[model samples]
Target: MSDFIPVNEPLLDGNEKKYLQECIDTGWISSEGPFVRQFEERFAGRVGRQQGVAVANGSGALDIAVHALRLGPGDEVILPAFTIISCAASVVRAGATPVLVDADPVTWNMSAEQVAARITERTKAIMVVHLYGLPVDVDPILELARKHDLRIIEDAAQMHGQACRGRSCGSFGDISTFSFYPNKHITTGEGGMVVCDDPDLAERCRGLRNLCFQAHKRFVHEELGWNYRMTNLQAALGLAQLERLDWFVARKRAMGRRYTELLGETAGIQTPLPRTGYAENIYWVYGVVLEDSVPFDAEEAMKRLAALGIGTRPFFWPMHQQPVFEKLGLFPAERYPVAERLARRGFYLPSGMALTEPDIEKVAKGVKEVLG
Candidate 1:
């Protein structure tokens, strides 16, 4: 029997150890180190932004970004219901309402049409998520933002190097965020970053990161904030990983293409597909959505795959359908068909950066055998 394949494993063959040693030698392993600054600058520039604020993790990045916007009660921020809960949680944390939109089955991102339909006078922003490394259709969303004078928080946590129409994913919004968790396009052990063009917004995020202290008086707090700072240890790892982002993205894309080629003819499931003119499927995790005709859902499929020594993960359950949100009376009558289907039937294969050709082939074979 072949070894069990994990859903993800990061590649850390670059300067990870060397930079970490340098940080240790300098005794600057905490957040206030040079590597943190270097990582922020390089990552922001790489993602086509003018400034970057490093944070403890991706969720912290979202919290600070939403805080920087100063949203409050009654503000409505449109976003995909098919995304990770953190995006919606950020808005709710700011005393705002998260207007949910369904995912586009092809792109697996919020449908722009749904966003427009949900817009109202109170709508202050649109949280554009580049889900599964597939950039959302931002052209119409940007146009909508412009018409309504609203902000866009581009959640590019899964889209380190992915782009739409030649523009980088993180560069499309007024404020953008990322996550450097182990399974992301890159890993910092655990860290995240915020990128933007506005100096004021950037400063606000920086202040929010460090307990909202005034620049002149470090300990004097004017507004409440959280200690969501990233340390030099994580920054060192991130800088090394960021240096190889292009190579990593290429490897991921190759993995996606290979998996699709191997499983394209399978009758029970559909592989993640890229839109011709919009974007290529970076296949962040090389997801598969089961056909309605299939006898079982993703849970049963994952069980069979696991029994074959293949590790798999289910897709994000839609926010609207979540029991927590339902308890809060937040989507009482709201129903998004596409998101509901994705929650029930979608899941990704083991498309980690460390996966070799043989590993992918074995995983594909396992998938075929289990689905058949």
Candidate 2:
């Protein structure tokens, strides 16, 4: 028997302990602590944003970002059908309609052309989620936004250190969001942040994160808001992780290249695209999609891999196919072929920062053995 390789394992051997010790020693464990402010400032600057509002998690950040845009009934937000449910759920929860577009078969990102086709006069924003490892073709989407007077909410949760052309992914959105989950490029145990250039928008996000509390009159709320504030402990860990982000990205790239090399000759699966016109794949997770010739779907493949002591995760189920949304009469009878196919066949291997060369070789061996 061998060790079971997890799909993700965060590496936190940086200044995480020292900063956490500082937080504990100074009694600043709440969101008001110094580390929180430091993390917010540094992370914002890193992404070329003017302000960053740290939140409890990535989904909460999406909720706040959608809310800050003041969307409601009669408003429509166009997003990808292939992304995490949080993207559409945020708009749905805001009383706005979520118009979904299909993903590009190659990149697995929302297609700009599809987005253009879905836009209506009622469209208020485009929630662009940079998927798996590559950024969405954003320049066209930006042009469409400008032409239609639409807001851009960039979901850079899987794109921490990725860029499009020469610009950072998170810097492109009117309101950009990031996740600091353990599986993400950076980890805070659990955290998220919203970054933006507009001071007013930034202020609105800050207020919304704190339950819309009045600065002059504390504990009194006027508008509705949620307590999605990130604590000092998470911030301390995030700040430390931020310092090593470039290194983490490099390690991930190396790991991806290695896996691509090892598994390039494997049959019945399609590996991630190494590069696109706008940006290279960061390999957030080294995803593999089973080909039509494959006898088993991702579920069976994952089960077989699990039997071989390898942990795997399925790709995001399409939002249009989600039963919860179906119950709400959302995306009724919607069919996105590319997204549906990817959802059924795609799964990722262990490509975490903590993964060693031996781990990669073992995982690749297991995958080849199972698929063969």
Candidate 3:
């Protein structure tokens, strides 16, 4: 197990220890501490947003964002069918219907055109995710939302430092969310943040993150909320991670390039290619999709890689095909062709910021050995 390269490993050789020590010394370990606000401000500033409200985790951030929007059962929120359940689950939890759209085969993000087609009078918001470090073609989404008078909530959990055209991924939306899970661009171990330009929505998210209690009276609650607050210790860790985010992003990009260089031409597999010009694919992980000629699906390929002491993860299963959705009768009649294919064919190699050149080489070599 020690010799096996895990799918991800957090790189924390920064001020993480120093700040954590400071928090311990000061006894500022709870959610209401200086480090929390500092982390919020710096992160919001980095993402080009006016405000950021820290939460417990990515799912909690999504929930708070949807809740802040005040969406309900009669309303709808459009998002990609290819993403994690958190995207749709947030909408479902807010008593809103989740409208699923197919993914773009090229970028693997949701198809903006498909999203445009799915919009109805009841549509209240469009949640756009910059999937796997590749920014969604969000200009058209912005235009579509503007024309329809709908809000855009950007999921930037996997897209730190990635841009769309000239703008930041999280800046195009009415509100945006980020995750600090260890595998993400930056990690706070388990944390998330909601960023936005509107002060009122910011306050709403803040209130929603904590129990929506009145500031005047701590025990007096005006609305329902969750205990989604991020502790000062988490914030201390986050601020440390944020300090070297640029370096982390650069290292990841390099690792991705290395994978593509090694595996781009591998038989029966389509490796992720880096794009230039504008906002390039940061290759959150160097994903590969097996062609039909391949003898194995993602599951089989992953097994083979595991035997080689390599780590890999399959692409997210399409939301439309999920058993939970099927049981709930959510997307029984819906289909997303690209997402469906990618689910079976695609998988990503070890791509954490901690990966070394040799680590990437080993992964690429193992992949070629498996699929060649």
Error of 2 at 330 (Å): 0.8
Query: How does residue 114 of candidate 3 score in lDDT?
Result: 92
- In model 2, state the lDDT of residue 276: 89
**Any idea what lDDT model 1 has?**
0.90
Q: For candidate 2, write residues 178-249 as lDDT tens digits.
A: 999999998899899999999999999999999999989988778999999999999999999999989999
Model 2 reaches what TM-score against the true structure? 0.99
Question: Which structure among the candidates has the greatest lDDT?
Answer: 2
Best by TM-score: 2
Report, for every candidate in turn, its global Cα lDDT versus the true structure: 0.90, 0.94, 0.88
Q: Which wins on TM-score, candidate 2 or candidate 3?
A: 2
What lDDT tens digits, residue by residue, belong to model 1 across residues 1-372?
A: 458888888888899999999999999999999999999999999989999999999999999999899887989999999989999999988999999889988778886788999999999999998888678888999999999999999899998888899888889879999999999888997889999999999999999999998879988788999999999999999999988989998898888888878999888898887554788777788899999989899999999998887888999999998888888889888888989999899988887899989888888999889877
* Candidate 1 lDDT trough over 10 residues, lowest sum: 273-282
TM-score of 3: 0.98
- TM-scores, all candidates, are 0.98, 0.99, 0.98
